[model samples]
Target: MDTEAHVTERDRSSDPDTREGEGSRSARFLDAPWRRPALLGTACAAFLLLFSTFVMQPFLIPSGSMEPTLRVGDRVLVNKLAYRFDSVPQRGDVVVFDGTGSFVREEPAGNPVTGLVRWAAAAVGLAEPAETDYIKRVVGVGGDRVVCCDKRGRVEVNGRAVDETYLYPGDVPSRVPFDIVVPQGTLWVMGDHRSHSRDSRDHLGEPGGGMVPVGKVVGRADWIGWPVGRWSSLERPDAFGRVTAPGPVGSHG
Candidate 1:
C-alpha cells in the first residue's frame, strides 16, 4: 500500500499538463507569424544606421551660414567617399568638415553610448551632427591665393576675378577685409552667407588662421536630401572657371 501511495505522489508531481505548459511557452516564440518580418526589419534598420554613421551621413543645416544655397533646416547628403581617394578639396565644392580642433571654439561632447545614438540619428537625417562640423564652399585649395574685395569688390582666387552670382542676393563678398594665401595641403573655405558665417575669416586671428587641413574634411555635400520642396543636387559652381592652377613653385602674387 505504501509503494502504491509513493507512486501516486510521483505521478501527481510529474503531471503531463505541467510539462505541456512549459513546452508551449517554448514553442510560442517559434510559432509566432510576425517573428521573421520583425527580425528582418531590425536587421535592415541596423544596416542603414551603420552605413550612414560610418559611411555616408546626412547633415542638417541648423544655421543660415550657407543661405540661398543651404537654408535653415535643410538636410544635405554628405558623400564621405569623395575625398577618400583624393588628397584635397577642390574650389567651388561645398564640403562638410570636422571643426573640432580647427574651427570651433568648443570641442565635441558625448560618451560612447550617447555618441552612437547621435550618430544613428544623424545618419537617418533626423538629428543634428554631434561634432563641430561646418558646411562651407571651398574658395581656395592648397597653394592658392584667396583675397577678398578685389578691384571689382569680388573675392579673387589666383589673381582671377570670380563672378559670384551664387552669392546671396545683395550680399557682398565680405565686410571684414582679409588677405591670406591658402597654405599647401590646406583649404580656405567660406559660407555663402558671408555676413553671418563665422568661417576661416572669423578665425583669421585665431590659432590656425581658419585654414582647415585636408585631413579634417568629412565629406562633400552632394545633394539636399530633405524637405522635398528644397530637394536639389549640389554642383560645383563654375565661378572658378577662369581661375588658374597654382604654379609649380606656388603663386608668387
Candidate 2:
C-alpha cells in the first residue's frame, strides 16, 4: 500500500489551497466557501470530508455480516487515532481493515472513474466499502491459541472460553472445527453474525492462514453514528478479561 498517497489525499481534501489538483472547484471554494452556485450543501460536504479525513470516519454497514450488533445501513464511527499512538488492538475490539492479502489474495483492478465514484460516496457512509475493506471482531491476537467448541460450543483463546453475548441469536460459535495459534502481529477475527460472515474461518486453508496483519488495520470501530435511533457504543466485551496472551515456549510449563 502507498501510505504517502493516502496521506497526500487527506491533505488535499482538508486544505482548500492544495485542492488545485482536484480541478477548478478549488478556486471557487476558496473565495466564498458557500456563496455562489453549489450553496450550503457544498460547504457541508467539505466539512464532513475534512472531519472524515482527520477525525472519526463514518462507515456504512454494507451487509448483515455483523447483524444485531451492527445492522445493514448503520453508519459506524471509526476512531482513526485509536490505534495510532503505539496502541495495540486487543481481543473483542471491532476493527476495519484492508483485506487484500489475508482476506483475499489481492484487490482487483477497476476503472479509475468508477473507483473514484465509489470512494466519494463511501467516504461519507452513503455507499458500501471499497472492494478490499472489511470489518470484524478480533477473536485472538498475536500468538494466542484459538480453538472452536470445547464441550459447550464456545470459542476458546489461550485455553479460556469466550462468552460471546454479542453473537446473533441462534448461531453457534462455529460449525467447523479447528485449532490454530494466531501468529505474531496478526489477528484471528470473525464477525458477530458468524454464519453470515466470511472471516478468518473461511480462509483457514489460504495463504497467511487467514490472519489479518495489525498494519492492515484502518482503525477501531467505537460507535454507531447513524439511523437516529440505532446509535450506541460498540463496546469491547469483557469476556476476554481473564484470558492471557501467549508466553514464550518454556515459560508456561
Candidate 3:
C-alpha cells in the first residue's frame, strides 16, 4: 500500500491578499462616518433624560425670586430623590415644586409640540421652567408656626428666630407681614429675596393658604451647576437648627 502524501495545501485564509481583503471589509464596515458619533450621542441623551427625571435635574433660575442664593441666570442641580424616602423637606432647604392650585390657579393647556419643546429646553436649563413651577426655601414644614417680621425684623419658626444670612442685601425678611401655621403635609416656603419673590406668601389668601403640599415638591436645589465661576454647593443653614417642632396649635413662638 503506497502511503498517500499527507501534505495539506496552505490554508487560503493565511494568504496575504485574503487577509488584506478581510481587513478592508472590516475597516469599511467600521468606518461608517456617522455611526459611532450617533450612537454616542444617543447614549448621552438617554443618560441625561434618566438623570433629569429621577436622579438630578437641571433648573435654570428664571427670575430674581431666589436672588442672592440663586441668581436669575444661575443653573442649579436639583436632587429629585432628596425626599423620595421616608424623609421630607426640612427647614432652610431650597426646593422646586409645582405651583398649580397654589401659586397658579390654573395651568392652561398648551400645544403638545410646543410643550415638548419647552420641556426639552427646560430640561437642559436653556429656558425658563413652566409657569406652574416655583422655587423657594423651606421656612416651616408640617405644622410649624411660621411668622414673618418678628420683633427683631426677622422671621421665626417654631418660636426661634432665624438668622437669615442668605437674605438678599437690603432685603428684609418679609415686607408683607403675616402669621400662619404650616398645615400638616405642607410647607411654608419663602424666597431669599423677599421683596422680589412671589412665593407662598403671595398666595396666603388663595385656596391653598400659600402652602405647597409636600406631594408637589419636585426636588431640593442642591448646587449651582453652571457658570463655572458661580459653582457652589447649597447647604442648609444653621438658622433652622434652633427651631423646635410644632407646638400647640394657634400658639405664637
Candidate 4:
C-alpha cells in the first residue's frame, strides 16, 4: 500500500496539465500591469531611432540663409541616399553637409554628455543643428564657371545668366562680386537670402576656395516636413536649365 501511494503521487507530479499549471503561475508573476506599456514604448523608440539614422533624417533650419525656401524653425527632410549611389549634387539643389575643414576651419569639441544631449535635441528639431552642419543651394558644380553680377546684375553659370526669381525680395545675387572656376569634385554653394547668408562667398579666400567637396555632402533637402502649413516638396529650379556644361580647365568665360 505504501509503494502504490508513492507511485500515484509521482505520476500526478509528472502529468502535463499539472506542469502547465506550474508554468502559468510563474508567467503570472511577470505579467504586471506596467510591463505591456513599457515594452511598447521601448519598441517605438527603437523604431524611430533606426528610421532616423538609416533612412530620412529631419534637420531643423537654424538660420535665414535659405529664406523664402526654408525658414528658421522649419524642419526639412534630408534624403541621405540622394548622392550615395554614384550620384552627385546638381546645380540648384539644396543640400546639407558637414562643414568641418571647409565651411568651418575648425571642428568644435564638446563633452560627451553635452554632445549627447544636444544630439538628442537636434534629432527631433528642438535644437539648432551642430556647428558643422550647413544648408545651402548649389550654384556651381565641378568645371563650372560661376561669376556674380553679369551685365544684367545676375549670377552666371558657364557664361549663361540665371533668372533667380527665388531670391529674397530686393536681395541681389551678390553684393560682393566674384569669379571662380569650380575645381573638379567640388561645388560652389550660395544662399537665396544673399544679404543674410554667409556661404561660399564668405569663404572665398579660405582653403578649398569656398568649394564644398562632393563627398562632404550629407543629403539633399527633399521636403519641408514640419509646420504643416509650410510643408512642400523641394524642386530644382529651371533657371539652371539654360546653363551649358563647364568648358575645359583654363578656358575663360
Candidates 2 and 4 compared by lDDT, better number: 4
Q: Give the TM-score of candidate 3.
A: 0.86
Sort by TM-score, best first: what order?
A: 4, 3, 1, 2
How high is each candidate's TM-score? 0.85, 0.82, 0.86, 0.87
lDDT of each: 0.85, 0.89, 0.89, 0.90
After superposition, the stretches of candidate 2 with alpha carbons farther than 4 Å from their true spots are 1-44, 250-253
- Candidate 3 vs candidate 4: which has greater TM-score? 4
Cα lDDT of model 1 by residue, 145-232, tens digit: 8888887799987788899877888899999788788788789999998888889998898888899988989899999988999889
lDDT of 3 by residue, 1-253 (tens): 8689888988989999999999999998788898789889999988887788888889999899888999988999999999986979999999999988788888979999999989877887888889898999999899898887778999987778899999999999988888888899999998999899888888888898999999999999999999899999999999888888877775552
- Where model 4 places Cα greater than 4 Å from the true spot, the runs are 1-30
Alpha-carbon deviation at 20 in model 4, angstroms: 10
Query: Please, what's the RMSD in Å of model 4?
Result: 4.3
Better of 1 and 2 by lDDT: 2
Report clashes for each candidate as comma-separated counts.
Answer: 0, 0, 0, 0
Residue 111's lDDT in candidate 1: 92
- Candidate 2 on 65-140: residue-level lDDT in tens? 8988899989999988999879989999999999999998989999999998888788888888897999999999
Clashing pairs in 2: none
When summed lDDT is taken over every stretch of 10 residues in candidate 1, the lowest stretch is 4-13
lDDT of 2: 0.89
